[model samples]
Target: MNPVATWRRLLAELLGTALLVTAVVGSGIMAATLSPDDVGLQLLQNSIATAFALGALILTFGPVSGAHFNPVVSAADWFLGRRTGTGLSLRDLAGYTVAQTIGAIAGSVLANLMFDLAAVDISAKTRTGTHLWLGEVVATTGLLLLIFALARSGRAAVAPAAVGAYIGAAYWFTSSTSFANPAVSIGRAFTDTFAGISPGSLPGFIAAQLIGLALGVGLLLALYPDVAAAAEKVVIPAERAARRQRAASRR
Candidate 1:
């Protein structure tokens, strides 16, 4: 891809991630405000809003940067595609991760400002414990498995809905409420709202997510030895935009 194309991809990752975090944090705040006494109702509202917004974001940005929005997803793409040379290069991976992280932080700050809260209100909700860590592991593992499995099956078209659905379900099933993305985990630390995760709990949650990434790779390899062929198209057809750019340039 040309330099311009590369920059476009990075920009898509940044904006897509920013919007995703905005939906997460903003919806959480809205839910809390609407259902102050009913925590369960708040969670339901948050999850539903997040799921719908996530699916829409993926559809919007998938063709550009694969809609990764998460460092773990980008890392997994690199790891799985390294041998076959079909996925993101090391440089691209680094760029995507950085963009996603910055976007996450920016989104959180924006959400806080929207709610009339301090821009850097650090989370006080302490989420720790081995059980919670286990939940993170499971949530991350399941997320990767779902994404890669869809790729391997040549079903990337459904990934937007599938991923959104999985995350929405994970929120209810997992003890940690499925903060499966490292970038998201870090972003939520900036808010004291219902979706926030305390900074102190970040290390353990991130570690578990990394571990889950490894286990997910192992499982994918075992289940589909030829999965490398689809590694570049994890959440969607990442090359579609590039192909369009190349074609337009030729004309």
Candidate 2:
């Protein structure tokens, strides 16, 4: 395979995140429409669709950018690999973050337009309370742990299925329905559908996710003492890096 370029990596992150958000918001709207009277059924439908879409997206984009659709994930990669220079550089992390956020917003607008709703309807679904915040922390922590653990264990090949499975399960287990991703949360705020979060709730949820990042770092240190060595392969191996190694070996 050809080495992936920086622009290709950024584009992968942008497109992957956009599609992920579209799946989330779109499925929620479809679920609500299909099962108007049954909230439980709607949630199930939404979760299933999101899970499948996420796994497919990761598989499609993993080699290009390591499939980091979440800002915290990219941050974690940079932090862990700073000493070793194995994971993303600071510049790459910044680019990925910007692309993911912009893609997420665009995704929300697209979802809304598809459903015949206002293109930029701000969500009014205020999700508050300490419980919800705590849920976000738990969800984020678990997600980080899973990703890092898989990388460290050399099981990154299964990340698509594993990550998708975890998020799907977290939806039912976490009170906040596993809005562990800040970009996703921000994108969701642009829609007033079942997956939407009020703009007012962004602060608390984002803070909780940050806290989760801290805790995840601590836990990863204990669980995978040398996780930094595997940081470059977190979600998947970057195609450019992998190609460079092959070229050096052949030389």
Top candidate (TM-score): 2
TM-score of each: 0.93, 0.93
Where does candidate 1 have its weakest 10-residue lDDT segment? 235-244
Query: Could you tell me the lDDT of residue 244 within candidate 1?
Result: 45
RMSD of candidate 1 to true structure, Å: 4.0
| Local error of candidate 1 at residue 93 (angstroms) | 0.8
- What is the RMSD of candidate 2? 2.9
Candidate 2, residues 105-221, lDDT tens digits: the string is 989999999999999999999999999999999999999999988877766778899999999999999999998999999999999999999999999999999999999988998
Off by over 4 Å in 1: 1-4, 235-251
> What's model 1's lDDT at 44?
98
Whole-model lDDT, model 2: 0.89
Clashing pairs in 1: none
Model 2 shows how many backbone clashes? 0
